[model samples]
Target chain A: MSELTYRDALNLALKEEMRRDPSVVVFGEDVALYEGSFKVTRGLLAEFGEERVKDTPISENTIVGVAVGAAMGGLRPVAELMTVNFALLAMDQIVNHMAKVRSMFGGQTHLPMVVRMPGGGGSQLGAQHSQSLESYFMHCPGLRIAYPATPADAKGLLKTAIRDPNPVIFLEHELLYNSKGEVPDDPEFLVPFGKANVVREGSDVTVVAYARMTVLALQAATELAKEGISCEVIDLRTLNPLDVETFVASVRKTGRAVVVEECWRTAGLGGDLAHRIHEACFDTLRAPVRRVAGLDVPMPYSREIEKLCIPRVETIAAAVRDVLAASV
Target chain B: METKLRAVLPDHELVKLYEQMVIGREFEEACAEQYTKGHITGFLHLYSGQEAVAVGATAGLHKDDYILSAYREHAQAIVRGAEPKRVMAELFGKATGLCKGKGGSMHLFAPELSFMGGYAIVGGQLPVACGLAFSAKYRQEDRITACFFGDGAVNQGTFHESLNWARLWELPVLFVCENNFYGIGTEVHRSSALPTVHKRTCGYDIPSEKVDGMDVVAVFKAVKYAAEKVRESGRPYFIEATTYRFRGHSMADPAKYRSAAEHEIWKSRDPIPAFARRLLDEGIAAEEELEAIRKRCTATVQDAVTFAEESPWPEDRQIWEDIYV
Candidate 1:
């Protein structure tokens, strides 16, 4: 094992997949000679050549749609959207075409494709650039949504997503791309989808989250540990399949749960998780399933306002503290 | 990749094209009758006069080449080797249909034959076609994807986006635009900033051509050359086949947009009989051979209708299956 940043781990995964499968092609604007918008695809063009690693026009719909068609034609295409914000332009292709092609086409065609987009807020990038759309993809069927919370999860889950025989929406946190952690050096290390990692295990309360929010949830768990609050931090690796069993079991033991999501509060993925928890473990709960999400407004540009808009470690700690105060 | 076409597609090929056009025309008319009898119920866009485009271009490609089209695709499906009974059963929402009755009319998919689908949303199939072409190039397969859409679809963002992407990536996609001069009630001039649809593909740097769609031999020649270039270079090409719909866009349309004189002029350009006349005038097929081809087409369509009528409905539980693996 060696320490690698989230971006490096993702890059390594792409390299490994390309070497492993010749059919795996990567394309995006500025993805080729310029490395990448964030250097995630650095050295790829030099290593793989233009045929496998391509720079596409700045058309989001075409980027996504081409990926879909290429996948249908029998290539494993990994398309990179500049950010999740730009993906809105391709929503018709992504939602109506990618998400429904399998089901609507009567299960004959498998969209074995992957769309990677960086989402979430922290750099004061404002509303247009910083947005979390994992919830939107999770709401759609025929697509697997992966939200890796750590570098290891990033590498392992991305490899799995690329190899899976279905269309997958992989959400990466823009803020965590430079964050470093130990990732396995093994080439065959692939994390299966829908399995949540028990980052911190406790019996008092369950804190379930994914992607960037999971890091905050763990930070909150650490701070709460000082006050004798034992919160089990569950990092949901895959957002769509959703490891409902892991969280449900955690909630059953703790009799309480708090769902954290970086997206807005109303109609967010957290709401769906909360509802699932309430329905599954209603009798086991000592308190209502609490949700900590981003503010229900466009992300603000000011650093301070942006900090307030997205959930923070302190907000999560407060929510956990408030839930524990109910004496579960 | 022969652009001039070999021997102008023997008289038999023209006769076969005439038969297909008649079958497509008769099949669409039957769909209207079935809709009245409550056998088919979704939005049905009939392609009564645009037969030459599908029959001509599809006749130009190899069976292994991939195909995708917009909502008005019953004719394209037939030309691309989809059994009419299965397609009709799919339209009828029966279990034995190509999509097991799930796709209705808009979302027809036949993967084994590489007939991907009939997308309902305007310009929806462009990216999927690009992806398919990309895959063929990635796999080093000598295949191209033929994607079809209407003149109204040219104004859509997917049209421009797909063209740029296919050219930028140099994918083997042959975009076939069936410019019927109308999108529902809106005319080509009304919907597009530039009414010349093939010229619109220039922004993407894709090489495009225009042909008289009423002439099946001309369409066949153009598509064959375009498919060859796409396969040879693993790049994209565009062609706009100028044609018209003889009937209304759908069964409910009264077609209040054009005058009767315009309708009569276009009806005179009806591809089926015109191509048939050319074949006879050129000593390609005798009148009796042409009548035999028409009779065969009518009988084949009748057999398809019987097959659709006998097909059963899909089970209720089937709807819950196949959404995922």
Candidate 2:
């Protein structure tokens, strides 16, 4: 194991995958000479050359459509949208082409491809730039969604996503890039999908979250621990192949749950997760499942107001406390 | 005196082209019959009057060249050697279909034949075609991609984006615009800024041409030249085949928007009989031989219908299959 930042771990994953498979190619706006808008593709052009690493025109829809075509033409392509919010421009290609190609074509071909986007509302980038569209992708079938919280998972899950035969929407949080952790150095190391990681083990309450929210949940677990509130923090590695079994089992043991999400509250993924927990562990529950979700509004530009919109460590801890205090 | 077409291809090859066009016409007409009987469901876009574009273009390119098309692609698939019976079964939603009944008329795909797929959304296939060409170039392969769409797709952002991307990368992509003059009910003049579809490629810096789509030989010659230019230059080329569809966009349309005189004018230029006349005049084929070819085509389409009727429905378990690999 080696200590690395979340950004470096992802860059390493891309390098390792490209080195391992010649069929793997990378492209997007500023992905080649510029390294990347976020520098996640740093040193790729130098090592892989222009053929495998290319800087495309600012055509989000075409970027994904070209990736789908390349995947069909027997190349594993990884495309990057500048930000998750820009993925809306490519929704026609993402939902209709990339997701539907394998099944709509009657299993004739598999799209071994990944579309990476860095997103989350924390830095007061305002309404358009800072938005969590995870639930938008989750609503669509025939897609694999991976959002890793820790540097270790950022490397492992991305490697697995690159190697998977299906199309993967690999989401990276904008705020977690600088956070450091011990990542496995094994080039062959791969974290499988549909498995949630228990970042913190406790018996009093189950905290379910992913991406940046997972970090906040872990921090909340640490804060709650001082008050004798043992909270189990579950980092959901992949959403589509959601390991509801892991969280359901945890909720069953704890008898209380708080589902945390950075997206809007209305029809959010938290609603779906909370419903699943209630349906599975209703008989074993001490209280109804609680949710800590982003407020329903376009993100505000002020740092103080922006912090209030998304989930924070204090808010997560409060939700866990609220869930524990309630009785069935 | 030998005709220009006689100099380009042998007698048998010329007859084969006529045969393929006949098969396309017969198959589409059969689909109309089946659709009326409720054997085929969903959007049915027939390639009736535009048979020449598919047949001529398919004949123009190499067998290994990847072909992608819009929803009006039954004729393209058949010309590219997809078994007519299986394609018919696909439309019939039978287990024996090309896509095992998963992809209906709008999404026929046969990878083995290098027939990529038929996209329902207008202009969706353009970028995909560029991608295929990009892949071919990246891997140092010789294959090129031939993408076919209608005039309706020209207004789409993907059409411009794909064209620009293909040229910027200098990928081997032949953009064939089957300008049937209508995007559903809207005429080409009404829908486009510059209704001359071929002229639009100038914005992308890709060389292009317009051909008489009613003349199968003209379409074949233009596509043949354009496809070779793309392959040799490792760049994109565009061709706007000026044709007209005999039917509405799909079965749902009544085609009341088209004038009766315009319809008659295009109908008189029907490629199948026009080509047959050329063949006879050139002494390339006898009248009895042309009749025999038509008979053979009709029989083939009939067999496809029989195969589709007999084919079983896909198993219930299959619904959960193929979403992931």
Candidate 3:
């Protein structure tokens, strides 16, 4: 095992995959000469040369569309969009083409490609930039969505995403880029999709989350442990083929659940998770399923207001306490 | 001015080109007939007036070369060797269709034949075509991607982005614009500042030209030359083929935008008969032989209609499948 930041883990995954497979290529705006705006693609251009690692014009739609074509033409292309907020510009390609091509073309082709974007609302990047649009991707039918919360998962899940025979929307948290954790040194280590991790084991209240919210949920669990409340935290690494069994099983065991998502509350992933939990463990539930989600307003520019918009550790813990308190 | 034509290609191949154009025109006429009879449904865009561009362009490219186009691409795929029966079956939403009825008229795909697809969204296929060419270049394969779009697609941002990327990477791609004058109801002059489609590629430093789309020989010569240049230089080239669509944009529109005088002028230069006249004048094929070719094309399209009528509907379970790998 080696200590690595989430950013470095992603970089290592790209380098290892490029070295292992000659068909693997990376491209995006500023990804080659700029070594990535977040430096996750650092040293890739130097290692793979310009043919494989490319710097493209600022065309988000075409960037993703080209990756779709490249994937159809038998090359594994990993495209970056600088950030997930920019992906809205490419929604036509992302939703209409990338996600629909396989099925639309009658399975004559499969897109073995990954579109990586860093998102989440901690850096105060403002209303347009600070959005977390993971739900938008998860809602799409023909895509696999993966958002890793740790360095190990960042490397493992990214490798899996790169190798999968379908298009993957690999979302990274901008705030988690600098967070360091232990990553397995094995080049072949791959985190499978649809497998939720039990980050913390408890029996009182199950906290289901992923990406940055997973970190906050774990923190809430730790603080709740001091107050004699055991909160089980479930990190859903992959959202599409979501491991509802793990969270449902956790909720069944705990008899209460609180789902947290960094995105807005209305029609967010939290609602989806809560519905699944309610459906699976309705008979065993001692309290109603609660959700700790971001406010339903557009993310603000001010740091103070932005902090309020997203779910915090305190917000998550308080939700857990609410569910636990209502149980008795 | 009547440009005197020389026998640039062999007699047999020239006759074959004439035969393919006849087949395309026959197939499109059948599609229109089928649409009227309610056999083929939903957004049927006929390629009647634009047959030569598809036939000539397809004939000029290698079989291995990739061809991608916009929705009016039944001719493009048929010319590149997609069977008319299966294409008709797709329009009928049958299980034996090109996309197994999942992709109807607007999205026909046969990847094995290197017909990437026919995208419905305007200019959506440009960047994807660039990627296909990029892959060929990266693998050091000597194949060029021929991307066909209508004049309407030039207004899209993807047109500019794809042109710049294709030229920037120096990928081998031939961007063919079928300038049918009107984008549905709106004419090109009202929408575009320059009004000339080929000149738009100048910003990317990609060499381009304009060809008379109604003339099969002109389109063939231009695309053949452009494809060769792209193959040799490993760069993208643009060609704007000035053509007109005889039918409306889709099956819905009546195409009231063009005047009766203008319509008469384009119809007088209809590619299939014009090319046939040239062929007969050049003593390439006898009148009896040309009649035999027309009969054969009609028979081919008739068989396709019969096949589509007999094909079964897709099973209910199939709807759930193909959404993933």
Candidate 4:
């Protein structure tokens, strides 16, 4: 195993995939020369030819549409949309064409394409660029949604997404790109979708999250452990074909659950998970499942106000403490 | 550069165009007939009067070239190698249909024939066609992508974005705008500030021309030239086939926006019968031959109806079949 940041893991995955498959190509704003806004595509242009690692115009729809056509024409395309907020421009291609093509065509073709978008709202980028669109994509069928927290899971899940025949909406948390972890050095360490990882096993409560939110939950779990509170943190690696059984098992065992989300509270993915938890583990639950989520308002430009929107370690810890208090 | 109509396409080719137009008209009428009988369901946008746009343009393409169009594409698919029986079955929502009844009439597909799909979103096919052209060019294939859409689609952002991208990359895309003057209830005049659809491409320096959509020979000549330019230069070319839709936008539309007098003025120039008269007047074919062509088109459509009626519904288990690979 080697220590790598989440960004490097993503870059390594692209490099390895491009080297393995001649048809695999990467493109987007600054993805070629500047190596992406978050530097996730650093050194890709050097390794792959300019034709393969292309820089596209600011047209997000065209970028995705091109990837869709290229994928249908027997190429594996990883089209980065810069940020999830910008995905609104290409929503037609994503929802109408990419997600529906294979099924609509009656299985005549497969869209083996991946759309990477930096998501979630911690960095104070404000309303236009900071919205988390994972829930929007999760509601749609004919798509696989992946959000990895650690470097290891990032690399493994990305490779699996590249290999999978469906169109994958890969949500990369902008905050987690700088976070470092010990990624397995094995070239073939592929992670399967619909599987949740219990990062820190515990007995009292289950905190469900993915991507950067998982890191926050982990930090809260660390503090909660110090307070003699055992928290089982479940990292939902993929949200669409969700590993409900894992959450069900955890909720049944712990008898208390808290869903931590970086997105807004109103009609959020956390709400969906909380509803599922209630349906599956109602008798087992000692307290109502609580949600520590982002404020249901547009993210402000001020750093302090932006911090107020997303869930911090203390915020998650407080939510877990409330569940603990309720049980007592 | 204006070649004689007979010189460009011989007498036999004219007859074929007539037959294709007739098939398109007859097929659309049949769809309306079946829809009324509760056989075919969903949004049925009849290409009753816009038949020449498909026939004239598809005639200019090789079998290997790609064809992408908006929702009004039953005629385009028929002109481009899709079997009539399958197309009919598609409209009928039968399992034997082109898309196995999943897409109904709006999303027909024949990748083997290089006919991509009939997208429902107005300008959704623009970028897709450009991407298909990019693939063809990047793979060093000499194929061109003919993208067809209505006048209403020109107002969409994808149209301008795709035009710029196609020109910037020098991709082979023949942007065929069948400007039938209506986007649902809104007329082209109501939508576009500058009404000429072909002139819109001038901003991107994509060469374009306006063709008489009612005249099959004119549409054929213009599309042929545009397709050739796109193939030769590997750059996007635009052609506005100024046609008219004889029927309402879809089966349910009342067409309350336009007047009967205006419709009559255009109907006098209906492409199918007008071309048939020209075929005989130009000494291309006898009146008996025209009757024979109509009989043949009727037979083809009749066989298609039988195939659709007999075709089975898709199995229930197939619902989750092709969403993923």
Candidate 5:
């Protein structure tokens, strides 16, 4: 195992995948020479040359549409939208074409491609730049969504997503890029989809989250452990092949749950997760499932107010305590 | 007369082109009849008057070249060797359809035949065509990608974006715009700032031209030359085929917006009869031969309709299938 930052791990994953498969090509706005807005594609153009590592025009919809076409024409294309906020611009291609191509074409074609977008709040990028739209993609069928929190999982899940025969929406958090962790050096190391990682083991309360929220949940779990309130932190690796079984089992054991999401409170993924937990562990639950979600408002530009919109470690801990205190 | 005919193609190939156009017209007419009877449902955009564009363009490109089009693509698919029966069956939503009843009339796909797909969204297929061309260029393959869209699609952002991308990347793609004058109900003059579609490619630095879409030989010659230029230069080319749809945009449209005189003028230039007249005048084929070709085409369309009627419905279990790999 080698210690690597989340960004480095992702860059390594792209390098490894491109080396492993010649058909794997990378392209997006500033992805080639500029190395991507997030630098996840750093050193790709130097290694793969201009033909494979291309910098496309600033056309978000066409970026994804071209990826879909490349995948259909037998090339594995990993396209990047500058950020999740810009993905809304490309929603037509993402939802209408990329997600619908395979099923609408009657299984005759499979799009082996990945669209990477760096998103999540707390950086004070304002309303348009800082938004969590995972639920928007989750609402659509025929797409696999992967949002990894740690370096290891980031590398593993992205490699797996690159090799998967279906179109994958790979979400990366902007703040987590500098965070470091141990990652497997093996090019073959892959984290299978639909399996939630049990980041922390406890029995009092189950904290379910993904991407940047998962990192905060782990921190909250550590802080909760010192307070004699053991919280089991579950990092949902992939949202689509949602490991409802793992979370359900955790809720059954803990008899309480707190779902944390960075997206809006209204119609957030938390609502769906909490509902599923309630349905599966209704008899076993000692308390109604609680949710710590992003404030239902456009993300504010002020750093002070921006911090209040998304879930912090303190907010996660408070939610866990709230769920624990509400025990029947 | 023989010299004029030979300038476009051999007599035998011209005859074959005529047969393909007749098949397209017959299949679309049949689809209209079936739609009226409620056999084929959903948005049915028939390629009735635009037969020459599809048939001629398909003939112009290599068999290995990738072809993608807008919703009015039944003729394009059939011209590219997709079985007419399978395409009709797809419209009928049968299990034996090209897309196994999943993709209806608007989304016919035959990857094996190199007919990529029929996109319902205006200008959606343009970027995809670039991708296919990108793939071909990446693999050092000799094939090119042929993308067909209507005049209405030119107003879409994808049209501009895809054109710029194709030229910037130097990808081998042939963008064919079937300028049928109207986008649904609004005519090109109303919808576009510049109604001249082919002239729009100049902004992207891609050379383009306009062709008389009603003449099969003219479309074939233009597309053939442009496709070869794309192949040899490894760059994009554009052709705006000036044409009109004989019918409404889809089955639901009554086309009350079009004037009788305008419709009559376009109908007078009906490609099938015009080409048949040329063949007769050039002594390429006798009237009896043309009649035989029409009979054969009618039989082929009838066979397609019968196949669609006889085919089974997709099983209930298939709904859960094909969503993922």
Candidate 6:
């Protein structure tokens, strides 16, 4: 294992995939010469040349639509939307064409492509820029969504997404880009979809989260441990092919659960997880399934208020404490 | 370089074009008949009067050249070499359909024929066509992508974006706008600030022109010239084929919005009979031979209907099969 930032891990994944397959191509706004606004595509143009690594116009819909066509024309295109918020502009292509192509065309072709977007609401970018739209993607069928919380999963899941024979939505958190971690040096390492990782195993209560929220959940688990309360933090690596079984098994063992999500409370992924946990571990539960989701409001601009809107370590720990203190 | 009508194409080739047009006409008529008989369902957009645009443009293209079209695409697919029986089966939602009955009428796809697909959304196929051309250029292939859409699609954001990108990338794309005058019920004058579709491409620095969509030879010649220029220059070219549709926008439309005089004027220039008259006047084919070709087209369509009726429905388990690889 080697220490690398989340951004570098993603860059390494792109470089390795491009080197492994000539069919793989990368393009987006300022992805080539600019090395990407986020620098995730740094050195890709130098390594792959302009033929494979391209800088496209700031046309989000066409960017995705072109990727759909390129995938149909036998090229594995990894398109970046700059950010998840801009993906709203390409919703027509994403929802109408990319998601519907294979099924609508009766499986005549496969779209081996990936759409990478950096998303989350913590950097004080305000409502327009700071939005967690994973629920939107999870709501749509014919799409696989991966939001890695660590550098290791970033590299592993990205490589898996590149090799996947269907469209994948790869969400990266802006805050986690600078965070360093020990990532496996193996270029062949792949994180399979539909499997949850129990980050900190415990027997008291199960805490389920993913992406940036997973980091907070881990922190909350550490804090809960100080109070003599053991919390099992299950990091959901993928949203669509959700590893409910892993979390459900954890809920059965712990006899309590709390789902943490960064998106708005209503229609959030946490609600879905809470429902599933209740359904799967009804008899085994000590208290009701709790959901610690972001407040049902657009992300505010001020840091203090924004902190209140998103799920924090304190909020997660409090929810875990509530579930543990509740009478059966 | 204006060749006489007799010399525009050889006798055999001219007759072949006429035969394809007849086949397209007969196939759409059969689809209409099948729709009423309850064999075909869904949004059926017939290409009855706009045959020449699909037939002529497809004939001008090399077999390896890719083709993409909108929902009104049966003629485009058939002309691009998709078997009529399979296309009909797709319309019938049979398991043996071109798309295995997954796409139905508006999404026929034949990858082997390089017929990319039939996009249901207006202007949805433009960027995809650009991407196909980009792939060809990136792989150092000498093929171009022919994208067909209607006048209604010109106002879509994708149309403008695709044209700009295609020109900026110098990709080989032949944008064929079949101006059937209406986007469902909205006429061109009401929908577009500038109703001339070809002129809209001037903003993108892409060269474009207009042709008589009712004349098969005109569309064929214009597309042939434009496609060659696109292939040579590695840039996109636009052609507005001024055509008319005899049928309603869809099976449900009664076409009450159109005036009788406008329909009559367009009907007089019906491509099939007009091309037949030119063929007879030019001594390309005898009356008996032309009549025989029409009968053959009729039989082929009938055979396709029979095949679609005999084809089986897709299994229930297969619904979840193709969403991923």
Global lDDT scores for all candidate models: 0.88, 0.94, 0.93, 0.89, 0.94, 0.93
Model 1 docking grade: medium
DockQ of each: 0.78, 0.88, 0.84, 0.70, 0.84, 0.82
For model 1, report DockQ: 0.78
- TM-score to native of every candidate shown: 0.96, 0.99, 0.98, 0.96, 0.99, 0.98
Ranking by DockQ: 2, 3, 5, 6, 1, 4
Q: In model 5, state the lDDT of residue B27.
A: 93
lDDT of 1 by residue, B79-140 (tens): 77789999999999998988899898888888888898999889888878888887887788
Off by over 4 Å in 6: none
Write the number of the candidate with greater lDDT, choosing between 1 and 5.
5
Q: Any residue pairs clashing in model 2, and if so which?
A: none
What's the distance in Å from true for residue B49, model 2? 0.3
Q: Interface Cα RMSD for all candidates?
A: 1.0, 0.5, 0.6, 1.1, 0.6, 0.8
Runs in model 3 deviating more than 4 A are B1-6
Q: Give me the chain B TM-score of candidate 3.
A: 0.98
lDDT of 4 at A2: 94
CA RMSD for every model? 2.3, 1.0, 1.2, 1.8, 1.1, 1.2
Candidate 4, which segments miss by more than 4 Å at Cα? B1-5
Candidate 4 to truth, TM? 0.96
Show the colliding residue pairs in model 3: none
Report the CA-based lDDT of candidate 2 relative to the real structure: 0.94
Model 6 over residues B272-301: C-alpha lDDT tens digits? 999999888877889999999999999999
Give the per-residue Cα lDDT of candidate 3 at A147: 97
Task: For candidate 4, state the interface root-mean-square deviation in angstroms to 1 decimal.
Answer: 1.1
Candidate 4 lDDT tens digits, A252-325: 99999999888778888999999999999988899999999889898898997888888999999999999988
RMSD of 3: 1.2
State which candidate, 1 or 4, has the greater DockQ.
1
